[model samples]
Target: MSAWVFDLGNSRLKCAPLGEDGRPGDVLAFAHDGRALDAGWERALPMRIEAAHVASVAAPALRVALLEALSARCARIGLASTQRAWGGVRIAYAAPERLGVDRFLAMLAAHSRGGAWLVVGVGTALTIDLVDADGRHHGGRIAPSPALMREALHARATQLPPVGGHYREFATDTDDALASGCTGAALALVTCSGEAAAQLCGRPVPVLLHGGGADALRPHLPDAVHAPALVLEGLGCWAQVGRTP
Candidate 1:
């Protein structure tokens, strides 16, 4: 039987069918404004799915709307939550629920890859979580991702275009400067975190990067593995544990 997995972020919704092997099939990405989903949201999903697993970091109203829409087609629906421990990864959070589910699942997915790892998620926000070889979480940091930072700046000073151009180490123009500055901040954080993780674990820490904004940051992160479906993979891992009750 097939199961569907959905990862709802602030700016996008990604879904894929879970195969019998517990791996997700071809992914479908839908771009959404903060307020409304695209018309393709209805047509993109299958008419009937055996099960639906979701990990959402979107607004509550969006969550409710997506769930309500899926209710008609799915035989069962499971929502992933931030937990103290799962799939051998022990969270460092004193209050586990305070940790975002996206971060938790990303760690879970990293653990499955084996060895010490630094997980960085680049979306509306940049989030980094470190886990050692033993699967103990060492906590993480959250910052406005470069994209958000640019958007905020433009909101304050309308002269700055919110979207345009690309990254340059030494930008000669306004658009490139914005791109370089934002992406550079994310790169600096990831590289520094990777260095720290390596020192703590006494070996090089492989970095795993994911999320919508990952592409913008990837060129600078030569050591990182870009796993776009990381959270969805973790959702599949979540489905494997007997949590489907």
Candidate 2:
């Protein structure tokens, strides 16, 4: 059956047709603000689809906009939300709704592989979640992503540019310093979180990393499993087994 999966984040929108193989096929990405969709983005989607599934953390308005657009082209639509338990993974949060669906979905994707894991999503924000071999969500952390860190600094310090520089072990120049410091900060956190997750699970856990900023974070994190379509993969999981709340 033909379906579609949409993952709408704070800064971008990604969608793909669900292949007969039960996985998302080619991805279509579009730059988006909380309110704006890129020009011709709508044209990229197929004229009609059998079903559409969404994993959205964009503003409510943006969520509405995209889902509405999809509704016109799809016969049925599904919105995925954080569940108390999903695909063998039991959420750790006392109030599951309080946890971001993106994190929950990432955990689902990781658990699909059937092992203990530290799921790290580096996007507009850096989200680190821990799930064990037995499918227990131990919890996670949230911090400024490297880009967000740079943006925070730029917003406060006009002299500092938000973009540029390289990651150096010991940066000597300002540009390198900003890049190094920001990237290093995130890397350090991922390391610390990984260690913590390992301790909880009683061994080294595999790290499943995904998100927009993941490429920048991945170089420093050599051990992480690169799963670019993680959230979309989770959306596919939900489509197969999850029911809307």
Candidate 3:
């Protein structure tokens, strides 16, 4: 039986086929802002599916819309949520629900690879989490992404462009300066976090970068692994364990 996984974030909805080997296949993304599903997007789904697993951090209305859409073509549907412990990973949150499931799934996926890791998600917001080699969650930090910073700055100061600029150590123009400063801040945070995580874990913690904005920061950090489909990969892991809501 064929299955599928969906990750609904604040900015986009991503889906992929779940292969028998328990890995996510090619991903498809649809950008939305609490609107109805696109006609083409609906048409794009497989005609029928054995199971549909979803991890959603979008608004409730949007989540409902997606679930409704899946109900028709999916023989079974599973909604994923944050958990204190699951599939070998133990979360640090006093209230596990406080942590975003996307983040949890990313850490879960990272732990499956068998090593301490500094997982960074750069999307609508920048989120960083650390999971030790033994799957112990070390909590994390959150900050506005470069794009969000740019948008906020543009909203406050119209003279500053909201987008379009290259990152440089010392930018001469205002646009590049804005881009450099915002991107630099995110890079610095990740670098600092990685160092701290290494000290705490007593080993070098490799960085794993994911999310839509990751490519912008990838060139700056050569060592970080780019895994854009990490959340979906983790969702696949979740389904593999037979836990679904």
Q: Which structure among the candidates has the greatest lDDT? A: 3
Q: Quote the lDDT for 77 in model 2.
A: 92
Q: Candidate 1, after superposition: displacement of residue 8 in Å?
A: 1.1
Kindly list the per-residue Cα lDDT of model 1 for residues 191-240, writing each as its tens digit.
Answer: 89988888888988888999888898888887789999999998888888
1 versus 3: better lDDT goes to: 3
Off by over 4 Å in 1: 243-245
Task: Report the CA-based lDDT of candidate 1 relative to the real structure.
Answer: 0.88
CA displacement after TM-score superposition, residue 192 of candidate 3 (Å)? 0.8
* Ten contiguous residues minimizing lDDT sum, candidate 1: 236-245
Cα lDDT of candidate 2 equals: 0.88
Better of 1 and 2 by TM-score: 2
* lDDT of residue 139 for candidate 3: 92
Candidate 2 residue 77 Cα shift, in angstroms, is 0.4
Candidates 2 and 3 compared by TM-score, better number: 3
Model 3 pairs whose backbones collide: none
Output the number of the TM-score-best candidate.
3
Give the C-alpha miss distance for residue 69 in model 2, angstroms.
Answer: 0.9
- The runs of at least 3 residues in candidate 3 whose Cα sits more than 4 Å from the true structure, single-residue gaps closed, are 243-245
